[model samples]
Target: MRDLQADLAICEAATPGPIQMKPCACGRCNQFLLSITHADGRFDPENAKFIVEAREGWPEAIQRALKAEAEVVTLTNQLYNCGKAVFERDQARQERDNAEDKVDRLEDELRMLQDALNQRYQP
Candidate 1:
């Protein structure tokens, strides 16, 4: 399984700003560009720290992947909880059986002692 916590940590540590997509204005073939803008709306394409080429369907694909990851995390946690619950239930059942067996043995001992006393008194 992928480490969900690590992925969350990475996202938390990423650039604290909004991502922007702008059209390439070099008068060349039509293309789109991507960049992370600071909180104050400052952007520098020439000195961008990180840049990614925007391809058709890339954004949608990324969104789908994120949704899938979230679902995986939720399902994995539920599965772990279910397994733990089953183990606890089994443990409780074993303890109950042990207690019932102990009670039966004690009852048998009491009956034996009672019978012996009755025989002695009759004699």
Candidate 2:
């Protein structure tokens, strides 16, 4: 895919007024900000039906924007994983606590039965 810089250059070269009014390839009106060549032999900028100023800033600006977007996506993924881990840990802890409580109750019942037997047989 063409880097943002190449795409921006195409936008800058196109006629500003017509390009602004023209519909993008996606059928959306002027939604395409830039275009660049792709590896699949697609995204041809030569036959672009629109016109815009070909500025030198196109590449740099697009690169920065892409980097920022990647960072945001990474951060979102990290937060989701962290939340899942915390939930799992809490569930495990609760299960352990419940098992301990059951064992304590069972032990108390056994001790009470032994004491009653001893008192009855003492005579």
Q: Of the candidates shown, which would achieve the greatest lDDT relative to the real structure?
A: 1
Q: How far off is residue 123 in model 1, in Å?
A: 6.4
RMSD of each: 8.3, 12.0
Give the runs in model 2 whose Cα sits over 4 Å from its true position.
1-54
Report lDDT per candidate: 0.67, 0.63
- Please write out the lDDT profile of model 2 over residues 4-114, one tens digit for every residue: 656656655654433222235667455544334243434345434222323434455677779989999999999999999999999999999999999999999999999
Itemize residue pairs with steric clashes in candidate 2: 5-59, 12-52, 12-53, 12-54, 13-53, 13-54, 14-51, 14-52, 15-51, 15-52
Model 1: worst 10 consecutive residues (lDDT sum): 47-56
* TM-score, one value per model: 0.53, 0.51
Model 1 per-residue lDDT tens digits across residues 1-123 = 334454445445545557567766678869656565554546454323223222323465577789999999999999999999999999999999999999999999999999999999985
